[model samples]
Target: MRKILHVDMDAFYASVEQRDDPSLRGRPVVVAWRGARSVVCAASYEARVFGVRSAMPAVRAERLCPDAVFVPPDFTRYKAVSRQVRAIFLRHTDLVEPLSLDEAYLDVTEPKIPSPSATATAQAIRAQIREETALTASAGVAPNKFIAKIASDWNKPDGMFVVRPSQVEAFLTPLPVAKIPGVGKVMEKKLAELGVATVGDLRAFSAEELQLRFGTFGRRLHLRARGIDERPVQPDQPVQSISAEDTFERDLQLYEFEGDIRRLAEKTWLATRRTQRVGRTVVLKLKTAQFRILTRSFTPEVPPASLEELTSIALSLRDRIDLPPSTRYRLVGVGVSGFRERGEADGQGSLFDDGERSPDSTGRPESL
Candidate 1:
């Protein structure tokens, strides 16, 4: 059996803020800028107890924990720390797949360092991280990626869990179906309607029945329900897309979305600078007041080279929306895709070359 480990830093951003500032050590800390549009990047455990969490609006976090200390995100420092943790992972195995700045999957089936078991290797890595970075991390060891990922979160900050190959089924059987990867609230509710509330319950449905109901995802659910995930851990996976979206406090008409579109575009533009790739497609996403989602995209011959060009293109996409002028929207998103290595794409297409616009049939955001 292959040995996989999912290592995740505990409240990474907030922990760093606390580690560097002694005065903030014991207090509720939130990492985010002060603004109506700002979202919480991370929340310390102290803040989490008060219902504060990452991705919630800063205003909501402030209201949830009135005494919380707010600190602006310092990505430069976070990236530096991430690099340090990555270097430590390399000491055990080269098969590291980073999911984000704070979490990664490592295949240690044939580790560089000698260990009696995957659990031992995980403990060693966690110990080394603590000694070197003065930061805590949680880890999960299992036969595959999905289960390892779930086990990693079973124990909170600075903990570890292991599931041997023989124990996979028993470990997964009683858990809620929502614990499966990709099983979000919508999927959970759908499964609930079918009398499938747990992994054990999901096992009762034949793969063919599920495939008839969920398409390709039905097959995946079949395997996951049986504690099977055949996917391997791949190192250094390339970035396919980057985007930012927001749900407004109130619904807005089509013309009223221009400002939000521009702001989201700028946010997406700044995020793209973190990578060395160039984006060839600009995408505009909208969610109607009734929760219907629509997307419009454009692929210019030449990739946008400046923030102004990106913003202008995103704003221009509003023209393609065929919805009624009175149609109100509750959310707006801006994105860039078709990433190419720097200098690999020679912008040869004409400017303002628009692509197809389509509404999501799944009533969900398309996976980037």
Candidate 2:
């Protein structure tokens, strides 16, 4: 069995704040910028006691816990800490797949330290993280990602749990179906209607029955409910797309198009920087006042090599809109797609090739 470990930081941002500032300890803390448009990015365990949560409006969080201390997000500091945690992980194995700044999956079936078992490797990694970063990390050890992810959350705020291969089924059977990844509110309700409230309940339905209800997702759910996930721990997974979108507090008229384009282009650039691959197409997505969607794209002679080029091309496409100048919009987005490794050979010519291009190019990026 492949030994997989999922490590998750506890209330990452809030915990970091509390660790650095002793006064914030034991107090309800919410990490967010102070503004009407700001939302909570993380809440301390104390704030959670008051029903505060991430993504809730800062105003609402304030209403929930009037004494809750609000702290602005410091991505730079968090990223520095993440690097430290990663360094600790690398000491054990290079088979680390980071899911986010504060969470990752590590395959330590053959660890560098020659641990006696996967659980020992997980404990060592968690202990190293705590020692190096003064931060607590919860770890779950299992045979696969699905089980490992569920196990990691079983114990929280500096805890560890392990699910042996033989115990996977019994361990998952009693959990709510919602515990399965990707089973959101709608999917949970649908499963409940079909008497599939728990993993064991899900197994009562045949694979064909699940397929009929959820299309392709049904097949995967069937396997997962039975404590089976064949997906591997892919190291250096490639990114599929890069895009940035923003929702404005109030609708904006096209008269302010230039400002909106600039803002969205900046956001897109920020997202692109996070991925190592380059994109061949640029897309502009606009949401009108009535929520009608309009999209324009451009595949330039030379794919943008920098954020400035991306913004310039995106702005040019925005100017091509046929709508009346009075068009009002509530959201604007910029995206880049058709991503490929920098030096990887693409069947199609280089994005900058001057030869005949595909008609679908429309000098635009592909859609979701």
Report lDDT per candidate: 0.87, 0.81
Q: Which parts of model 1 are misplaced by more than 4 Å? A: 243-253, 256-281, 286-333, 338-368
Clashes of 1: 1
lDDT of 2 by residue, 218-255 (tens): 99899999888888777677776677777677778765
TM-score, cand. 2 vs. native: 0.79
Q: After superposition, how far is residue 247 of candidate 2 from its true place, in Å?
A: 5.0
Positional deviation of 336 in candidate 2, in angstroms?
2.4
Q: Which ten residues in a row have the lowest lDDT in candidate 1?
A: 359-368
Return the clash pairs for model 1, or none: 301-349
| Cα-based TM-score, every candidate | 0.80, 0.79
lDDT of candidate 1 vs native? 0.87
